[model samples]
Target: MSRIPTAELSRYLLAGQLTRNGCLYSQIPRIPPARQLRRPSTGQTRTLNTQSDPTTTPTTPQNAPTPAITPLRKQLKDQAKAAKASGKKKKKKNVDNQTVPGWDLTVGIEIHAQLNTARKLFSPAASSVNDKPNSHVALFDVAMPGSQPLFQPETLIPAVRAALALGCNIQPVSRFDRKHYFHWDQPSGYQITQYYHPFARDGCISLQARDGIAAEDGEGVEIGIQQVQMEQDTAKTMAQPGGVHWLDFNRVGLPLVEIITRPQIHHPATAVALVRKVQMLLRSVDACVLGMEAGGLRADINVSVRRTGAEGLGTRTEIKNLSSFKAVEDAIIAERDRQIAVLEAGGVVAGETRGWSLGSTETRRLRGKEGEVDYRYMPDPDLAPVVIGEDLVARLASSLGMLPDAEVDQLIDEYGLSAKDAISLTTIDNGSRIEYFYRVLDALEQQLGIKADIESTDDAKQRRALIAANWCLHELGKLVETAPGVETAALSGDAETLVPSAALATILAHLHSRRITTKVAKELFWRAFRREISADTVTTAIDDDGLWFKELSQDEYAALADEVVQGEEKVLGEFARFKQGKAKAYPQGKLMFLVGKMMRQGGDQRMDPAEAERVLRARIEEVHLSGLGE
Candidate 1:
């Protein structure tokens, strides 16, 4: 018996075999390397290719091919290396300086939005939108004894739907945790939320960069989403002149969806756009009303400034209770500048939470890092884990309407609307106005057998669609904006009630088909909307036989226009001279004055000014030709 050498044993192990080292063997067996190995053939011994020949292929008895690494495995290894390199590059690119550094901006947002539901999350009390302060309160709202928190299925659906629309993944199981903090408004001394296992995670929103700021091409920067959790809203606190804070418990125990974003936003404008996008998305899914002024939605912005290539994030400061997009932008800029100034003047930019003073356009310090209070987060003992099923997700997916960004894109592509017009049409002012406008459009389109053109078209269709969009954005917007003493709900409801679907469709259809001028459609719109007249009635009334034209005969109107030209003889002469290649300065001032007088004499009906101008030029030409003949 002979023992195998350690080197031979190592080689055997590399060839996928187990062999004992320094052990005597009664019978010696030989195995080849995998690359030169072959299946055994009956009554044949195969020889391995150990020669240094590059071209001569290895020949084995069974002709079995050697196993090689798969392409996918190779590709995976390459991708891992690339990712590692990218991460290293990012780490090495950090630039840090004591004086003002490089001013790298990072932002994160936390939104507290009230859910639009019929009942409170933990109580059976009504959650009506119009309920008076403290009127919809349950015993639990006041921390009543033995009051157990009960989950609201109805409220959770909207939040889940909203998160799904934002591209978030819903977790199978979510647990409610109690966040404890003492405040006069928080009677229970804690807020129940899903801190550990949130309902949804990793949602994203897209926003455009403002002028002078550079954004990435095609796809914008991806801001990592932390979580969107369901929580109970705190009661309202009203401060009186005598330093007394009165508590209203009506809103207590209401369901709220708190959406938190990662600190990836770099610019102030991007932060503002992200907030706006989130607000619109929440409203689109009917999760929360997008009310910034009345506090239906509130945002706390965390912003920090560092050197452009810094190693780590700078000291972050939270701007609390920003109710509007403008205020959020102002606060970020103000805070960034303040921090930069501090660093430039040899002062440390301390990590703190501050409140944005809208009146002063500044952020005042509230609490420093040393003074920061902990919420004492713990799992809620009373409530069990909320298990969401496929049925609920499917139902929500079906009902979750188009996101605001998608709607804007559709309007631009389908209706040939301008960016500004599309934005205006999709924006919800306190949520009610946008809903009402859409309801009106929807009903009108259905009633008039017209479909919404959400696709792009050629020149003719583009022009018509632009006209329709302009009318909707301008005339309709004015009606909604100026409706006196009207609550947003009333205004929205009234718009739906008063603006007949059939008439609106008729107007849009006529504009789409280019059958009516924009001016004529506007006049008809006022008549139909304010006077409750039908589209046909307004069209007929303004047509040849209608009262609008019947009030002034064509012959008399022509005579009055002729008289206007005669009164503006100097301007007419100049216009005629310019047309004849004399290139005289036309008397625009006098011609407009004469036209104004003629309009007054003709009962002040809205007329197309360009058409009137054409008529005046034609009449002036006729008079000049007659004079030449004479």
Candidate 2:
């Protein structure tokens, strides 16, 4: 690890770049794709993949095929079947008898989230992860023989806010301890973590049981939080299979908050939901990004199974550093079933730490799980206890803007949106998304001449808000997904980035009143979102694109309908069938496309789209009544 260059770490991490060796090095507060930049001091993780060596890797420029996916349950069943056919009767029965009924599945999780601060906990080396490995490292980070550890109070402020958000009690005085461990990444020989006394305790997360492993995003059930403590991160260790491991000390000495939950979560769905909610809430406070796969945030899960009403806990195994929420859920379910299988076959479960392989849908032993006594932890003699005064805690607490849950409630109560819609709008785990949502809503109301402070008695305001919300959630959401490079910055809460408020308001106003078709609105929106158009460009887009509300009279509609039917006889027979009472499909799908074509006939979007359609339908009925076709 020490042999690796510091520049390599900073480059790959801060740039979020794919390294030469194909390892995953992510920088916290990921910079824009347009600019070469690193975050102020954020998190980065080392995800090494030996198979990604480009030298040995075969290249297919296009059409890279994907492997077939087998369901995890199917995979497990197949494994059991294979064992049975091989005359491994004992192991076969153990695997085959792994039913989950009546067995209590208990899970507890320990999550470490990197604080979004500007400097290291003890040094000023820009705490960010850079592509340059040692670029962010201070002398103290590498254990310069004469360097001493210093405390940073700024780090504690976020720690307390994170705890407050989690409903934990903040302690006035918290002590640091030296946790002795030997890992290639820990250049100092021991990690500075909270062992005996932590900053906050007695926290709880309330949620509801989700439906299944595939649909675990819903909130459910109440889970008790044990504690959230502050700690310093160790350096990153990039390993080469059966070879030397590379170390990047840039991550060393960064502040991290470890949120530990109780073993009361017996449902896989609950565990997944809790972790996701934690990520959302923490980000709301701008505490940590949780960087899951990128290393800003990760969870260590403890899994055990016992009799439904058992008096004692079953032997448990720990899966270390399961980053993705999906991985967390799948690991717990797989491990729980495995424990059930072993216990049913009268084999004892091993108390070990395991590593999850996403490709194989299984877990393998990493080492025997370590307990508190194994570390021989002691108070750090060099550092003194961190003291938090009431004034500081109060100021920090009062400064915390609306948390995620509060925002969710506000969306539901004020806007009259359903809980499902409200959660979807806010739970995307991106702070910029929610910020943009309300900003556009406010702009829409102002464009409609409603004051920001006054609640309009007109239901029209609510209707407009719904339209804006729908557009923001659906159309804008798709834009971000499909063209994230263009739309990400604007949606990322940079007011000056692109897509000014006035243009958004104009588009939403036109859309809400059915003055323009959704297609027309989207065409103009992309211009704004990509910054190709400036403020108040919606009007120009509408005028230049020949898009305007045209209320067609019955005769005008009849003329266009006649032209369309004569030009294309495709739907004439269908229209005849509607008159013959053989079918009641008057709202023909083909007619809608024909109507759109007639409205766009002159290379212009002209018409109150809904009214034009209604008039066109009436004209068709008139043709049936006035004997024009019959």
Candidate 3:
């Protein structure tokens, strides 16, 4: 056999491939080089002419048939024309009626809150956030060969409690399904989750007007809970140097309850409030560690927008792994606006998963969202169905304890607290703050000789209670968070030990009765917190410093005021010049100067500045009037 020459073989192949209309390479006329391509302007489609003709120029003839447009292209063109015409119509309507059109926003959320338990969902390994990376993994967690799942009550009980607390209808028999996905963080190719039959469903969390900025109506709004499912968590992925990633399997197989909400949230603030309420609910039951800052809780928000009266939803986007309340609101707003802008600008919004950076104003696309079919869900052959007995449910319900809402109502009705303050107290630290608040209230009541009657309309008692609440929550809470040399963790369970409730009550008692000014009370409170004074000796400390106020008779107050006025001549002259319209300084400044002198001479700045100013003003007025008459 003889091999063909390299150039002849290439020529033959090119001739066979490029020949058209049975023309040989040498006889065929070559088409002219195509013109430089021009980019189409915005909202215009660019079409390239691909027909072959040597005699014709790059531009097609005016009588040539229009290019055949596909159904998709024609649909897109029609949509663009409709968007522009509708935009013009809406603009004209707005101009005529002086009213701008509005877009209705709808938001649904999927929350993954880590279940609080001793072990992983299907393994005996411990579930912890602070454990060494990859140190807590078991054979099953890493998907080792022949390692079977072993579900325990520790995982199910907490999820059940959480679902019950949310008023969910618990299914007696819920089975596990495998959701298939390929990711570096997942050891197994599929994750075990409750899909076809979730553990709980058909619950709702009520949002009050005071709960968020969006709930303006007094009756507020109710956000429905679609379902709650049990699932296994994926491993933690940490970005390494040099564009690498490291996966820690410790988090794999950890227990999680995915709470799905209905698309009833219309505002970002309402979404935030719902998340907060969920956190409070789970933490109250001790079922989950819903700590957003600690990665224990994450939310995926689905946001969409349409014309106010449009029937169906617009194209929606999913914002994934929002770990903060602010991020939830910001991501929803950003995605909602992006979809609205796309629609108004004659473009369609694609359904995709997006991500939000810490300080970013807009969301960036991560990947196209996977549909139900993409996950390829199937029942897990290895794990058996989870069956809950009515006895177990009954026992759990009996011990359900008080939830955050109940605590909020109790605080409001019993303690005379405002709704906002009541919510704050009830939600913080899983109602631990409210317990501390009650202790402080008890101490204050005992010290002030006030009866502990819930129905009593005693204004003085309620006023004292408010005083205690303000100091404990505002002042002491700040100290607990930002005190130097004290770890925040140390202040959690033993917060009262830092400054005993007795000491706090004493400070409040003195401040309430005007025995000491607010400044002195704060100083005393801080001193007790720092252990400068013992709780048992708080009264002694105040007395020794001469900071305690003694009720003064009328004559006694006048005498003390006259002595201070006669001694502070420079301050008096300044005040007199101001009274005669000669001094440029404000009158309050001269009065404060005189009050300071009185407090200093009186041996303690703890005296009420207002009382000192009033007394000194009277004495100074008497002297000035006598001198003017002379």
Candidate 4:
């Protein structure tokens, strides 16, 4: 089959030889003919073939030739059939048996993100939550008749910073275009967005798979980013009883970084993971709070499942307003299943947009593909191009602080911590707590004049590192977890009265040096933190109370130890019995109960579990006891 070039097809359409009915013609008249042409020699004779000869055939005039189109018509029909067949084959291949039949699903996503800034993008309106709706709206945001659209410099910096952090390329010049759409929530019929040149483009994000642990296999898959643009949020929609809706303009004009991802994501699980990773990165840079419950961020998921070797994507339907990560995941799976079922039932899934109903956990189509409304997009003449200079980028980079990913990597490499531990520690949001924890480590090393060789640490250094890590993870983490949602700065201020870094260092140093037992160290740590006493003061108090060296009196200690030995006799007998051939039923609960009683009787002083176990084992061996009857 032969194909006509696009240029020739366009020319045919322009010349009116082809009509919308799909017809082709050799010649078309320019205008209505006024009269027929007549031969000069014969005034009333009809034009016919002339110059007939014995050996030569008569010639037909060019303009007066017969209009025989059977050959041309056959050629056109053959070409059309070939094109149609080719198209059908391509479609069939796209819908081949590679996929599970019966389902027809499509997806689209709209992300509503809270811009990382202190103020609204267009107005001097304080970007705070407590501000009144109308009060927060600047003159421009309220669409004051003569007011010009103004861009907030502060807002742009964070937006750009977030874009760069996401590995996006910042366009040198990006303009805000007006997307005209109507809603009561949108006081202005148009929204300012970068439909043409967005702030960031061609980026990627790596998402962890559903595995409980980080896979040993290199990093996770990279989801290709489509574009990240700055846009103003519409007003909050409040649904009231009786089918009425309320609009709160306070949310309007709030800067948002709308990050769109390509539909390249295949698996529903991967989609969930990608959203999580994106949320993590946004939080790491302090770009978004990512409070799914608070409506701080939302995702619009686009999903389309096609058969293997498909020439193009299947009909894509967008699931909008997936506020929670769980919802995003559930919606994708649901849509995929729905699509497969439709296909299997010999029904076509229409390309359209849908909204996820959290209550029903089903997607309802809002509009079909052809029904999509044109959001007339044009450059906003009132606003100029956003110019991003190198200085601004540098400033933003510096202000964004250390991202969590980089911090996690540092913790793993520098502290030799496990990936899980690093993720946990780096996820700590209390900035002051993080700073204080580091400060304590610094003071400990300074006071002891100990240089930690993390790579080749001897026994002493390893012990110190372990102590530091344990204290941070167990003791400090417990405190932070129990504390209310207050910044670490407040806690640090209270540190002077509570356990200061100096005091913590002193106690940890003692623990690291093995001068105090684990029980003693824990007690001292609690006391120091509770009383907010200095190390010297805590040490002196312990000494003055004879709590530090009271155990040095072997006779008294031995007596207390003997009491524990007698009390845990049953446990000791069980240990011996387990060693023998006869194995009787032993309850770990009962053993722990006896251990607790012994520790309590000794005032938790003479013998901790470790010491008690050691003593019990030795005494049990010495006695050579037989098995206790069940």
Candidate 5:
């Protein structure tokens, strides 16, 4: 190769028009001030290469004419026109089948519930909430350097019980993967979750109409669970005004179970029912806290709308972080209508994530929907695959108690309680009321001086069970929940003090033996609930033959009825005047007047009004006939 002098090569490379005009070194590409070069034609634009001679101009054959070059401006306009046409075609295609008079809504949910455990899933740090901010964080929780996750075996115990309760097929071997994302709440820029292999799958919850959380019809419905996997929770991010956010690390690294459901829900009610059923199952198995209002449970609802008889599903939108059943219901309805409206307006619904406010009726877009590729899921290198043995699962299953539905059925079939009564008994406080129900039954049997078998078909025992259920649910539940002037603390304390089951059984026994009316028994119930009457007083009153309540037997009522008719001369005269006044209809008002006098004769309100009226009429007839004979 020939080498040029350093000074000459530098002068040629650094030469400019300004250098030449100023009589100094300048760039070499110099042209006249007013002259310019035209852009090369599309067909004449040559590819730069070392094999081609720069001085030669290539020519086409005479037989083939030169191709016309399109203008740059016109080409841009054509491209925009084609893009617009393509977008219009897509919009029309989406709207064509979606614009119908009636629309059907389909919904699915993904719920994340904080597992009930003492410690974090992968760290030894204690798990708690509403404590000092960032207090629960550990080295691995914040993803410090050289820190690795150590899986806690205790978490799998409750998780297995929950899976068994929900009728899930527990996997023998499950693995964790790292889902990569960038967010302020994620310290590691990735979340450890069960993606390709979850701990459990293919579970279902049976919702009964009697529970009032199922379908509108009488039959029951089952919500199918697609999968339930364990994952670490994200930190709490509180957004403030002016786009500022505060992060609380205490929530980060908490153990959670992400439950994904299949899209079988066709109505908002069904969706709410499904969530409640799952919550009940979790609570029954002591798996998750599920205090949805307190951030222990969060659900993401996927909703879509399609025209009736449509072949496939339409575009779906997800409403994230719904913490209540009302929010779940309202968000689903609002998003369904929104998609239907967009399709009916000759527009396309964008696939995106959305958020819902508690009182708002609509959903706001959070972001465009992210596909699986966007998450960049890969197996976690540091974590080992979780291996659950059959022995462990069997042990957990054996420890499980009877779930709420079975308890309800037992209350109905064995105890002879109504369906509504049985469900109410088992639904409150995770079947605490039902436990009280059994206590009341045992107490009632002991008070009545008999030991009744629950499985026996004795009418007396069935009657007693029904009576006890009514008192527990209608009277006790009402007073505990809404009774005025009742101390809340007293109601929450030991059941023996808060209207002892033994005393309540005494009141029920009086009502069952026809010694007192339901109204009188209710009065005694409140007195007992308020501690105005003790269990000793209740037993003493029974021993003294209704000293406290003044309950009248059938013979006592008959005697009182006759005495009032014969003793009240003014009342008898009033009846006689009414009978002789040529009135065709019977004087029910006068009869009630005599019955009232009989009720007030003993200065007590314990007399049965029906019995008083019946006996008083017979005595009045006997007196009138004797008067005619005289």
Candidate 6:
């Protein structure tokens, strides 16, 4: 077989035609490329044009369209050639984004947050990701003949909560539509979605802008969430050893809320932050635990650019199935540069769907994006309109306590955490841990019998909250981060299962009373966490582990003071001259440095720096060096 021309292979792959190992993987119903195989998000799609091979140089038979490489592989070649010719190259950024002299890039994201539920959206089948292949499939899930979708009432609850958390206006009436798509996993031939009317819309989320001309400083940027639709997720498709694709229907009909944001994001950091904010919000409400690796949450990003300060949105291309926050940022940056190069080279940024591979920096065109109409979206006759009552919406809204914004404010105002640290503590990824931390604070205050009125004083509360926040965010978080499967419910267990909240409080309280050093407090907290060691064992470790802070008795103090005065007699004369303001070599407060020689175990809670200063000053006074105050 002759080598396929790069451009010809690219065009064919862009058109969704591919062959591998003599098996032709045709575009199965040629569904809209931007939407999920099962559920759809806020996006535009294009009509597929079924024309003959457009490449004039192709010689391969129609039966075998051997694509030895991916579509983006060809695009990368084109990008490289353009860079070589124009003398402009892709910018490499490890810390910050490089400036593009004439272009401004904008991005938006669509998140499919898989609902954490036991059953599929429309069927009673188990929606377990770990279940055996096809073991959890229901008749409705597989589109068994004569099986119609019976809407699950429980599905709308989480969607409403997610929308409320996002500050969206819930629609009283939303309808489902049939979306035509082709994939073996989707045996139904069509997915039921809210194409014409979504469940919620018109919400906004605020994110910290990168401090520069790209974003205004001091003020955070707010991106609009266009709409969130409640839809079903598709099944998993795995490629076998010999070009065979296997479909697992176990994930079929899983609940998902497709969140679409407006294309106002300008910086890659902002884009990643926005994705993280959404993840935080979802976890706060238990609406979804969209871990990127769990396949629970995924996003498709749309990016486009234009001449700086010059116009309406440009032709956009999408990067799909971004699984992590870093992936979200990196893919956007790569796509932004690729589109800039294409436009600069006198080419067009095609309206197409692309896939991002973790192994490559470039994006591969998966299929040409289609408009909603191309999917032939029409009302699903089998399902009725989803009606939400005022009471139900109100209930969900009321239940969204301490959302990202409110939680951040409370942490800053009440807990006295810095704005940056507050943001980290309030996010959903660590949300459960933070909540558990708060409970420990309350339990600690109660155990010590600290009155609410007394402990609620701003200074008192903030001091305690800071201590708790520090331990939780630093020590506990480090442990949790390294702990496998920390994102799961097992990690969300009650504080008692780990270290009891009161036990944590005891550590902090001991720290405050100087009974233990901060270093020892952290160690005790860690040993007591997970309830592996008894509370009494934690207390005893302060002594047995030699963590007790040592204090100098009066005799010990006098001995050190006498030794310093006599041994450094020459230095003492220099100090006397320095104090007289006549002869000074280095001036940075002579007493603190003088006492430095006498101090040991800086972390020792029992050692008082002020006492050391007082002792040293008094001992020197016996030698009549009284001008040190100068």
User: In model 1, which regions exceed 4 Å deviation?
Assistant: 1-101, 209-219, 369-373, 429-464, 479-494, 506-521, 543-630
Error of 5 at 209 (Å): 1.9
Q: How many clashing pairs per prediction, in order?
A: 7, 27, 0, 25, 5, 7
Lowest-sum lDDT 10-residue window in model 5: 45-54
Scored by lDDT, the top model is 3
The residue-by-residue lDDT of candidate 4 on 30-99, one tens digit each, is: 3211123254555643211121121343344878755554565677677668878787543222113223
Error of 6 at 173 (Å): 1.0
Pairs clashing within candidate 3: none
Considering lDDT, which of the candidate structures 3 and 6 is the better prediction for this target?
A: 3
* Candidate 2 lDDT, 1-630, residue by residue in tens: 344456664444333234444233333332223222233466544433223232343344577565476787888788878877998635322223224668878889999999988888877778888667767888778666667888877788778888988988888888899888875467677888887899899998877422222232344567788888888898887763333356678889999999999998767766777888888778878788646756799999999999888988998899998889778877877788778888899999999999997634468899998888888799989889988899987898898888777777777777776666677777553666566678888788776677868767646666776777777677766776677575546444444355566677778877776677777788778888777765566777778867776656666766776676665555766776667776676746977887777777623444555666676677667663456343
Q: Could you tell me the TM-score of candidate 6?
A: 0.75
Give the distance in Å from residue 99's predicted Cα in candidate 4 to where it truly belongs: 12
What's the distance in Å from true for residue 430, model 2?
2.5
The candidate, 3 or 5, that scores higher on TM-score is 3
TM-score of each: 0.67, 0.73, 0.72, 0.66, 0.71, 0.75
Ten contiguous residues minimizing lDDT sum, candidate 6: 30-39
Model 1 lDDT tens row, 1-630: 665455554344333234554333324443333343333545433222232332344565676665554576677677668878777442221112112335677789998888878888888888764565566888777676566888878888778877886788899899999888766567778889888899899987656532112243224656667899999988777653322344567888888888899898877766767777777777777777646766888999988887777789988888888999778877877788788888879899888889886534358998864331477788999999999998889888988767777777876787677677677666644444445545545544554454566532466545555655565557776655666543454445334554554676666665454455565666677667676578566556656533232234556656778877655566666666666667656657656776677766665444444556555556666764355421
- If the candidates were sorted by their lDDT against the true structure, best first, what order would they fall in? 3, 5, 6, 2, 1, 4
Question: What is the Cα-based TM-score of model 4?
Answer: 0.66
Model 5: CA > 4 A from native: 1-101, 213-218, 238-244, 452-457, 481-497, 500-503, 506-524, 527-537, 540-605, 608-630
Worst 10 residues of 4 by lDDT: 45-54
> Over the stretch 1-630, how does candidate 3's per-residue lDDT look in tens digits?
554455444333222123343445458555443323333444432222232344554555789876664576677677668878776532222113211258888899999999999999999899985776667988888666567998876799999999999989899999999999976567677899998999899999987877764733346888899999999999887763323345567888989999999998877778888998898889888887657867889999998889888899988889999999988877777787788889899998899999998756589999998888999999999988889999988999889898888878876776678887788777666567777788888887777776655444657656866787788678876777777866665436445756788788877876787878787888898898888886578788988988766655566667778886676667777767766778777577777776777777774543566677777788777865356421
Q: What digit string (tens of lDDT, one per residue) describes model 5 on residues 287-329?
A: 8754675678899999988888887888888889999987887
Estimate the overall C-alpha local distance difference test score of candidate 4: 0.64
